[model samples]
Target: MASSKDAYRRKINQNSDLGVMRHQVVSLSFIATPFWRKNGIGQRSPATCRFPKVLGTTKGVKRGLVLPLVATSSQEARSGVNASELPNRGADRLREAVTAREAAFLAVEQSLMQNATTSDVEGTNASTDSKMSRDSPNASHLSQKFLLSYLALWSEARKPSRAEYALAKIISFNAVRQRMLFDYVLQTNVLREREAMDSVPRRIKSDNLRLSVSQRALLHTALAQYAFMERVPVHTIVFSTVELAKTYYGQRFASFVNAILRNLARYGEKWMPELERRRPAEYIVRPLPFPEDNLNVRYSYPGVFVAKVANQLMNQERVVAFLEAGNLTPQIFFRIPCQFTDTAELRAALEIGLLVPWDGSRLSESAARPWNIYRVDLNCADVDGAGDLVIAANTDRVEWAHALPDTSAKDLFQKLLQKFIVQNVTQAEHIYDLCEQLRARWNQRRRLERVLDLCTAPGGKLTAVFEYLQKSGLGDLLTEYVGVDLNGQRLQMVHENIHKAPGMSKGRVFVGIGRGESFVEYQSGFVVQNADDRSIVPSFDLVIADVPCTNSGVLNRRPEARWRLSERDFATAIPRLISLQTSLLTRALRLSRHAVFYMTCSILEAEGSGLVRSVLEQFPEFELSWERLTYTDTAGRDGGYAALLWRHQEN
Candidate 1:
């Protein structure tokens, strides 16, 4: 036991990027030229050049520490370097001598602006600063700056226009994904600046000017680019951010934003050197800040969610990897229908099948064919503005749709069957194989005709069942695929997905708007409609009750989920979701004659294993035939749980 414990300890101490930050900001340095070629490095991009080093090096040292530009000498220096002047190069040698002076100037400027700007952030002691009296009634136009707006979070619950929503994801997804890290960096930096002020020393107080929501949103997006998006030109980041602040707020707020971004460019670089290595517009999936981080802060996941993973796994390394995996945006998964055996399929199949060894199936031989599932290469997968597919997103769960691709185009997917977020598609693939195996077994004695999806809105799983039934030549065996969902708008997705598949259109499917926990009326209608056979009918042969979850396991797919969940008192939700899940599962079990597939896209024990365990203990009639609670360590996959509850029958 001692040796076993020691071995586990050794695994935790593995050489994972777990520890304090690597780079440290020694001090600010004055440089002749702007970092981004006064703007852009043109051909010499960030990919080939090391960051801060690309900016400029002095005394054999790399200095990324920054201060806002306020000069013609800097401009002359930049133009000179761009033109390759020896005199400008000579001036660059004096960077060390002017470092102290630049640092002092920055401190003085900040101290002068400290009292006025401290309140522009979330957490700061601004009570020490006195408030100005109300503006004169004649100057009411000044109040327009207070009207603030932020980028709306895209969710599965909301139905947004495809084009407009696509724009939102491009603007806000990564920024929101790294909200915690950037916010923490800003909050801490704000505190330090407040302390530098000649103000009260403790017990955090605030009454200073607060950042409008729009300003904060703009700031976060800017910081995400400035700090995390390494390949973005520094000039673009700073100029755009400053202008955004100016347009939304007054000129004062613009100055505040300029200063904050400048400090972060220097400070955040050292605080998060990991950004130096990441690709442009890409996300960070490794342990952030390098060396180490708390599970929640490290991945920007909620603390409750992290605690759940920690408690469930009881292994630090597994927990870290699982969290990291959640941040990995898998290459887009394109579900290609089996019937589309075009020239595109013949060519694209070999490439896709080789890239992904999904379910141990890939086309090495010319005789081999592609399955319905294929991961799309976005680079190769081009969308013409003239094309039908207006690409919604590359990473987000809510936008896993291409505006119904051009049917005429002879692309890889050949009119594309469907697009699903990695987690959803992964779950569907596993469930599809499981249900297929069950159907084969059940077919020996009975047809196993009826199926029920208890909560099937935006039906990915139900559609997978359709694919299985049609492809396996078992379309006739299943009579009814009943779908019950509360949301009418989302239930329409089920109809669309079903219609997309060949031979599985309106014939065998029945959908109704109703609650999952108490949907006996819908089941009754289906059974009565099919009472002609009278084969000792149960409401459904297979019941799918994939209940609602916190979605802790797929944080990368749904960047907004954690923040929204945090706001909804997630701590109290445990008992509530469990109760809801239990009732839904109970309804599913009662409705199923043969098997009830209970699933949740969650890693928490209570939601998955523990809940299943209790269900079995109470209802011994249903045995656990197959069950799995998986945590993803590898990238491009997601964590989730599934349990098959089957009623044992004697031969």
Candidate 2:
């Protein structure tokens, strides 16, 4: 609508507006423009146009350059000339700056796209180092791999699975022999590193953040592998860890992981003196500077558990010995089944030498002499030597002189003899002795009838009872054998074991899934009712109530329990455990017309003697016939407590 000069002026102003928009979008500090000076739109003196202090250094730009649309000064705004009067140089310079800014914006967008694509493929093997040798035989490659895989899966909290047991077996293989060593190394390092960070300087600590769950697991595995892989070079350990980090996580984490493992490999021996000791026994038995203060850290036991043990043992030295014994891998013992009388079959089944019987008389003069025999004195007071059972060593039990570690013998016996072996195979000697005493008491009474086992899952004691009835020539006299458990799964296991036991008919053995306290409630469908159904639920001659306890005495076999258990757990669990035990025992006493054997694997008086005393207080009609508190140190067996009670007979 206007003349050619006005139209030209409008076109120049529009182009300048676009140039300002491009500059803002690209976030550039300033763009040089000789066109502005040539047109006299801004300061003509180059010295007067400098970059503002807010924008960083302008090394690339010429002097007197200014950002588009940014005001130069109040005087310049008031004195500005019209665009129509300005020359074409100003528009030309603006167009050039716009083109440059647009190009830069494209470059930034392209860079962001590339980064997103790269992040998509982050965990791929692109950044992995090739230094890790998968075929290295010096390292326990399988064990390390298994450990890493397992920790990755379980480091985050979740319910335990059977896979843990399988992993334990693989890690503890004789070929590896790194289970305890590795566990100790990993746990100790994790605790120490976590505590050590608190002591770090605040300034340095800001940059040094806490290790993440995955990071902690990886670090623990690396340090553990380094400690036990004596045959592997230190560089190999470091290299493998770095490669693992880069491959699984990314390069960002690789350097941090590599540094931790390298430091441990280099300075661990001096910093942690325990690492220098290769044998678990060495570390276990060594006296600490302050035994009470260092008990948890040195022994890898819960502080409360250590305190309780130290208190019970009275002497500090004895406490140490007891703890050492618990950590030692136990020896294995196998009892010959009554069905297999052939010595050759027995020897083949056990895969160990057959010594002369408890009677010194040999099967034949040419029979193999015992390899080793020592007359060790028996230390317990309850077990008395009787007739030929008593040796000059004041021990009632005869010696079978072969010694083998449990691990070596576990698999063989488990594979061959588990199903068909005696009612009691690989059972603690003290348990067998207790059963024998129970059998002797029954023989004295000369009356064997119904038997009830409360808290019977996995059916060990029930099997022993069946075997006793058969051997004592009272199998036909026993009308019923009942086993009860609250857990249906465990009750099923008891049924399976009972089915496999010899001299036991399926009809004679009853496995019930019910709470021991209210066992009669579950028997409704089975026609076992109140006094109206007299024949269905008859009185039992014997009731064996082996109640649940903390199992503190069997820590040697259940090492994982040490970590899973805590002092607070004990405090919370003990009251409930005692309540359940009391209920079970009371029910057993109610059902038993003659006698009840109350038993527990716990060595704690609160669970054993104290519990029995409480029961006696509640029911004064029952008299404690005999009681025995067996110590692992004294009996040379797993610790347990048993009290036999008999009902006071009415006139």
Candidate 3:
């Protein structure tokens, strides 16, 4: 029997397809195991378990023998075994082992498939749950990470400052206006597309999908570039986004971000046509079918505000033009000092255009007049100082007093003017004109012994008052000038601006830190009495209360203001602003001996006319002498409301 087995083993080993037999033996081990026997196969002995090892080995062949052995001689035949029959039995066992192995493999594959299916369903459920409760602790961490990572400078505690706006614009490719729109698309459109492709629901809120700060910022920039900016190439946008992600996030996150942006680039444009077709009447997409509705989205003006403006203007065409005008950056107008030499040369070099003189004679014809025809008269200076000079070339849009040309000339002119004429740059608005008019009118009545400028930070009105005093030949008569502001930084700015004037001495101008509401009265030309302590301060013949209000009129100059101002914001702000304005005006009335000029940069009736009406009703002693409300839509300058109030004193 041993000889017969040896002969069979030698025959198998000698065959080139022994490797195939070894594979069969290895697979049969799975069926021979006790675990398999418990399931279906019959229980085998320990000798049978060693069969696979025996087949695998080259040196030793002795092991559990499953094959039925046959003898070659007559003596072996009597035992029902033959050498030739043994080979056939071996072949039969090998075939049986292969069949058993295949059954085991099929069972394993089915079990694995079932387990995977169960796990996938569970994962899907968990993902759905995560999306539903996106404000979970984990999601909060993600939200915070998203905000901090992209917009490091932004915080919920404070509003975005000018410096922050500037920084955001630089990183986000000047897409500051489209920030909210971009976010809207990302949360609603982009996120939806991603969710459709992926089975795993993104951990995103249905209403407000929270992305990492970097992710949000990058998405906004990319979308803005892809949708609006045709000049910017797709690859450049992708590269910039990837680089930004890598800089803030790790390489792994960068790869993840890269995949998302690439997907956007591929499929983003296809949706444009559909979006346009499905766009709501109020909402506007690019390549506008209706130009009338475009300003609401294109200029980023709130729909409510746009409707309000349309109602106020009473003309949809005018409303569109006004909104369009507001989107443009206003021209920087400079007031040439009486003392600055080479006025003609500067005017010629700059190609400076003059503001239409406010004499009321050429009110209609001024819009048609050429730029060169308008003259700057230094000797007979009005509120605008002869005439205001636009630092850049004027545009053909005659609706604005000056629409600055978008050219290299504008850039070069701004640079030269800033370098050469440092402190002469003044915004040509109706408020400044009002300030100058107030100062001139008061000085004409009686020389100003002292002047008080309340809330006088950024110091434009105060500086104008000083310049007016100098130009009107009342510089000697003005003994002291006092500027008070609640903000310390603005008070410092007042001090700095005061120092710029050649005639203004250190002792002449005093910038103090105090709320306008606190200072109710003044005793002498050198003393002020508030709730705190009595301080030596200059009493005033004139008090200019340029109180803070909703900067609605100057929306054209301040692009971010449109987003910041809402109907709710105005509703809440107007009442508080009215209170503050009332308090400041009352205090100014108490302090001034001759006149008080109450001014606001708001076009709203509630902020200007309403506030003034309330004050007049409260104080019967004061009378309104002169009031002017310049509307930007009509006047082509920033709209403002100014009322000159004077007390009737017994002779």
TM-score winner: 1
Better of 2 and 3 by TM-score: 2
Pitting candidate 1 against candidate 2, the one with the higher TM-score is 1
**Rank order by lDDT, top first?**
1, 3, 2
Least accurate 10 contiguous residues by lDDT in model 1: 125-134
Model 3 vs. true fold: TM = 0.54
Candidate 2, position 547, lDDT: 74
Provide the lDDT at 228 for model 2.
32
Query: By TM-score, how accurate is candidate 1?
Result: 0.61
lDDT for 60 (candidate 1): 28
Give all TM-scores, in the order shown.
Answer: 0.61, 0.55, 0.54
- Point out the worst 10-residue segment of candidate 2 by lDDT: 126-135
Q: Write the per-residue lDDT of candidate 1 for residues 548-623, one digit (tens) a residue.
A: 7655556565554455345334545446666777877877777788888887777777778889888778777888
**Which model scores highest in lDDT?**
1
- lDDT of prediction 1: 0.48
Instruction: Please write out the lDDT profile of model 2 over residues 1-651, one tens digit for every residue.
Output: 777545544554576543233232321111212222213354433224332331222344323322222222222221123424222322222223221111111122222222212221111110110001111111112121222222222222232222222222222221122223333343333222322211121111111123322233344345433433233345655775575455434544565555445444544444345533423435222211122335554445667877877777788777766666555443333334446445453454334432222322121221121111111111110011100111112111222222322443344344433454222111323334444555555544454667788677667677666765665554553457887765554565576667656657544677776556555533433523232222233278778887766556654543333432356556664565667677777777777777787877666777787888888887787888777765544223455678888777621
lDDT of each: 0.48, 0.43, 0.44
Residues 322-369 of candidate 3 have per-residue lDDT tens digits of 665554323334344445534554554335432223333221322212
Q: Which residue ranges in model 2 land beyond 4 Å of their true spot?
A: 1-208, 222-249, 252-254, 268-280, 283-293, 328-333, 341-344, 349-415, 421-431, 439-445, 474-477, 521-538, 630-637
